[model samples]
Target chain A: MMLLKSESLPIVSEQDIVRARQVARQWAIDLNFKLIDQTKFVTAVSELARNTLIYGRGGFMLLEAVEKDLRKGLRAVFEDRGPGIPDIEEALKDGFSTGNSLGLGLPGAKRLSNEFEIISQPGEGTRVTIARWT
Target chain B: MERIPILRMGDFLLVTIQVDMHDRLAMTLQDDLTRQIVASNSRGVLIDISSLEMIDSFIGRMLSNISLMSNVLAAQTVVVGMQPAVAITLVELGMSMPGVRTALNVEKGMMLLRECLDSDDSEVEDDAS
Candidate 1:
């Protein structure tokens, strides 16, 4: 994958979540993603960005436009230096949340993306990367 | 500190969500709507979400919360004008919004609220007899 362009946005406050969604939507539109695809990608960004703020204790989101295998895609990486997850599998389950939310952020975001990846450790931190292709 | 406005219209409260709501704003709207419903003695609440291009679980929960809260305050809530893309995304995100009532647009939502209120009034009258 080759990075064509990229930008980073903070996820310290609730307003940042909305900004993340807007940035994702614009990137999806630029990629010529279908309306539904754009909505799906942006919704995924909202979920992950919130997790980065609430669960991760404030992080930054890295947005990237990339080209891979002759296909264009938008990638977002949310990284936080908070208490990490001990059980990655459990954290990815629907309705499994420790933040008093609906517990759909991780799983829902994974479902909405073409590719999803996560890395976490008990005392370290967590990083989630999601990408959607047009 | 931005807040969504709730307008009172003849026994109903009208809310048009024209901005991309942050979490705090969504919660604030929920609080304001419930308060307005009681203060105005509204029989129904119509929420227009046509301008919202996205509906994450947070906003979905906020809508459901508003509906549930209004019901407790003797007011029926009907969500309206959800974009097709948003509807599709909400469903796929594992949020069916089970107890929340929805309509195609503002006009239909108003009609549905009126019907619901009418039915409730008739039921109350029936119980009184």
Candidate 2:
């Protein structure tokens, strides 16, 4: 299994989203991921980064290339210590957002990835993990 | 978060959107553009995308939707001055922005919009006669 990783910088602002996507794109290219898979990775990364800035006060993201049973894939984890999500289920629903959001960030991220999971507790924090196979 | 209306040339209205075009703002822009096209019964509209740094799939879909909505309102929509990097990202994401004409600069975009508007006017005149 080939492994690669990156930690999100503290400059977690909306503008940083573009930089995060660039990193993800480079990682995908290095992994020799398929074009479609690369797109999914970039899109998922963008959404997560945006979430980190918008919802999660600030946080870090880790990305890794994984291989299991001869199948290649990628995994990403975004963790934040911001005001945690009070309701995970409602958050997953499209158009359900706490901020003045279109509510497409989480749901759209889920649609772009093959696997998605979220862990959050009120006043604690939120962590989101997503994976997609190439 | 300030939307600055930079110019209005003939049937085209050019504005600079200086905030993240996500969430409610994105929706608002789409709705407003659609309404403007319908109200004016414009032949064509041009939107300047120079100040926009990033556009996610949602925004891309909205742009396409706006274009289609304009058509339904009997108008054409064109997007101008998208950065190359943003374009590359959009392409990689498999976003097919439909019904929108893309141009390299505002001048070129305005030229196209004018031509579309002129042709539309001629057609309307022909029908009237």
Candidate 3:
């Protein structure tokens, strides 16, 4: 079993979201994720990164590789200290969004990954974790 | 989340895409349109993207996917009204949208679709005779 870890530099803009996705793609490829799986992983990361910038103002992303029950996968955790989600349930709804455009950020990220978890509080902040197994 | 109407004119389905189209809901719109084109076996499709402020690689890929999928279902897909900035970004990103037709505006896109449909009908007629 092998474990790989990396931390993203703090980013606060939309362009950084794109850069974060590029970093995530490289990591996925280095870990031998299938092409389609890599695309899914990148898409999920893009959504989260965009959210971090649009909603949280700025944040850091952590990438980790894990092995469990003979299965290997990639996991990402995005942490932001912004105005936390006031309502988690509402945020998870398919069409629920506080931004312009379609409200598919959270739900779409959830749909693209194997596992997704979001923990947030009104005053504290928001943490989003997602995993995709190949 | 605003539900943009799918405008139907003749055999073509026209959809106007707005800004912030990189979001997941926009991707879902692509999926929905693909399904619609397949199930209905439409003759043509024109997606107006004039309102989009930016187009990322993912959204470009989705548009390409829709174009390819529509072709398999015997439909022609055209993308119209791409902002210059969006176009430059797509090119800079080295994004290639194969099998997708692009036009400057909806009017031009409609004209191109008409020509494609006309040629297709002629082919069918020739095959029948």
Please report the candidate that would top lDDT against the real structure: 1
lDDT of 3 by residue, A52-82 (tens): 8778879888888877667778888998998
**Top candidate, metric DockQ:** 1
lDDT: worst 10-residue window of model 3 chain B: B88-97
Task: Give the DockQ of candidate 2.
Answer: 0.17
Stretches of model 3 off by over 4 angstroms after superposition: B1-129
lDDT (10s digit) by residue, model 2, range B86-126 = 67656644555655788888789878877887898899899
Q: Choose 1 or 2, whichever is better by DockQ.
A: 1
Consecutive 10-residue window with the lowest summed lDDT within model 3 chain A:
A1-10
Worst 10 residues of 2 chain B by lDDT: B1-10
Q: What's model 1's lDDT at A22?
A: 94
Error of 2 at B90 (Å): 8.3
lDDT score for residue A69 of model 2:
68
Point out the worst 10-residue segment of candidate 1 chain B by lDDT: B1-10
Clashing pairs in 2: A102-B23
Q: TM-score of candidate 2 restricted to chain B?
A: 0.82
Which of 2 and 3 is the better model by lDDT? 3
**What does chain B score (TM) in every candidate?**
0.97, 0.82, 0.89
- Interface C-alpha RMSD per candidate, 1 decimal: 0.5, 5.8, 10.1
Off by over 4 Å in 1: none
Q: Candidate 1 docking category?
A: high
RMSD of 1: 0.8
Candidates ranked, most accurate by lDDT first: 1, 3, 2
